[model samples]
Target: MTKAWAEEILDWNYEPPYDFYNDNNKEESMKELLEAPYFAVLNDSGNLAGFYCIGYAAQVPLGYLFGAYQEDCVDIGLGMKPELTGKGNGGSFIRFVLEQVKGSKSIRLTVADFNERAITLYERAGFKKTYMFAGEEMSFFVMEKRSL
Candidate 1:
């Protein structure tokens, strides 16, 4: 169910060093959008703190979800208001994503190697390194968390 505080979290720009699903790839973007299930956080006053999008549930990532493994695992993307970063909000947000992703083989995601802060948060959120992929343009860490 969409929570009362969810609206505040609903508005966000997930663009960054990784730019997880943005306007750049318009052709395939809408397809991914359809697959996302949103989760929101509430403040003490019951206002929304932030939100994230988890893809690959009954929801599909356009067609991206199909090629990347055939099980029930989800690919996660999240953001807090830029002003709310580094004070542990991100860690909690990631934990929230993990909670939503609970069950199945595992959750998978790619992180730019240079984004050490995010990498640390992922590690704290129980993500483990699965592989490293690099190209002339960038390098990333392929991380996964096995389901209990």
Candidate 2:
């Protein structure tokens, strides 16, 4: 992602309806986004739609979910622009991202329990809840999608 797009993404905020990631501390958020190895998700016109990181869950504290860093599976972290969410395009967008990943028989992602919309999107894309993990601030479901 370009520095400009990364800055824009770090500034994206959610309203009360989507408060799952509601953090008032922008500095920490920006740092985390910038430090993560993520790729820009661009729209058809090539504008940044969002950003995602492949296999990040295995490296973060969330590694507990994989029983000390399993390498046989792929785990993803995704963030869509706050404005683009709930506009009826998430399912297709996720599918397209999945298509871009290479050489993995299965993919996994973790989502906060409060993110019903994201859970629904993952479910529709054939992801099933494998287990749940409790983080310091919230609980999450580790969902998995196996290639058919």
Candidate 3:
């Protein structure tokens, strides 16, 4: 991801229930987002729509204890521009990401259990819940979609 886009993302502040998704540490988040696995998503107007990361960068450390990433699948982590969330953009946005990774036989992702909006979006994109694990303060679900 470009530094400009990363900065924009760091500035995004979601409202109440979704506030947890906001980036609190600019330095750390910038470092991660600029790494190889992460990519920027732009809308039709060429504005930053969101971002996604693949493989190890997408995994949650606590999930390892539950064997959530044991399977051979392309792990994915993603975020939408806060203002676009819950506004009927999720379906297409997810489809775009899916298309980008269409060559993969399997795809997986993790989502906070409390984020019904994201869980529902993932389910609609054909992801099925495969595992659930508790974090220090919350819980997360490992979901997968397979083409084979």
Candidate 4:
């Protein structure tokens, strides 16, 4: 992702409950986004639709202790523009992302258990919960999709 796009993503703010996904540190977030395993997604109108990251950037450190990511899978992390959420666009967006990572035999992602909307979306996208672990304040589930 470009610095400009990363800056835009860092500025996005979500409502309560989802606000935890907001970026609090621009410097650190920018560094992560511009580094490897990160990419920006744009819509047909060329607007920043979302962003995704692979590997370590996609995992929660605490999950490692619980053996949540021991499987051979492509771990992915993604977020949509706050304004675009809950508008019936998630399925297509996720499908597009899965297509991008279709080369992988298996894909994995971690999600907050409370975010049922996201969990449902992932399930619809063929991701099944494989493990659950507690975070500093909440709980997270490690979901995976196999055979592309």
Clash count, predicted structure 2? 0
Model 2: residues with Cα > 4 Å off, grouped in runs: 22-35, 57-71
**28-141 in candidate 2: lDDT tens per residue?**
766666776677899999888988888762234664755633536787888888889999989878987888774547888878878999999999988998777776877778
- Top candidate on lDDT is 4
Ranking by TM-score: 4, 3, 2, 1
Task: Point out the worst 10-residue segment of candidate 1 by lDDT.
Answer: 57-66
Query: Could you tell me the lDDT of residue 54 within candidate 3?
Result: 88
Q: What is the lDDT of residue 67 in candidate 3?
A: 83
TM-scores of the models, in the order given: 0.62, 0.83, 0.96, 0.96
The C-alpha stretches of model 3 lying farther than 4 A from their native spots are: none
What digit string (tens of lDDT, one per residue) describes model 4 on residues 1-148? 9999988999999998999998888888788888868989999999999988888999998998898988888989999999999999999999988888887469999999999999999999999999999967989999999882
Evaluated against the true structure, the overall lDDT of model 2 is: 0.76
Lowest summed lDDT across 10 adjacent residues in model 3 is found at 96-105
Candidate 3 lDDT at 106 equals 94
Candidate 1: lDDT over CA atoms? Answer: 0.60
Give the alpha carbon lDDT tens digit for every residue of 1-148 in model 3.
Answer: 8999989999999997889888788898899888858989999999999998888989998999888889899988999999899999999999998888876469999999999999999999999999999978989999999977
Off by over 4 Å in 1: 1-35, 46-48, 56-72
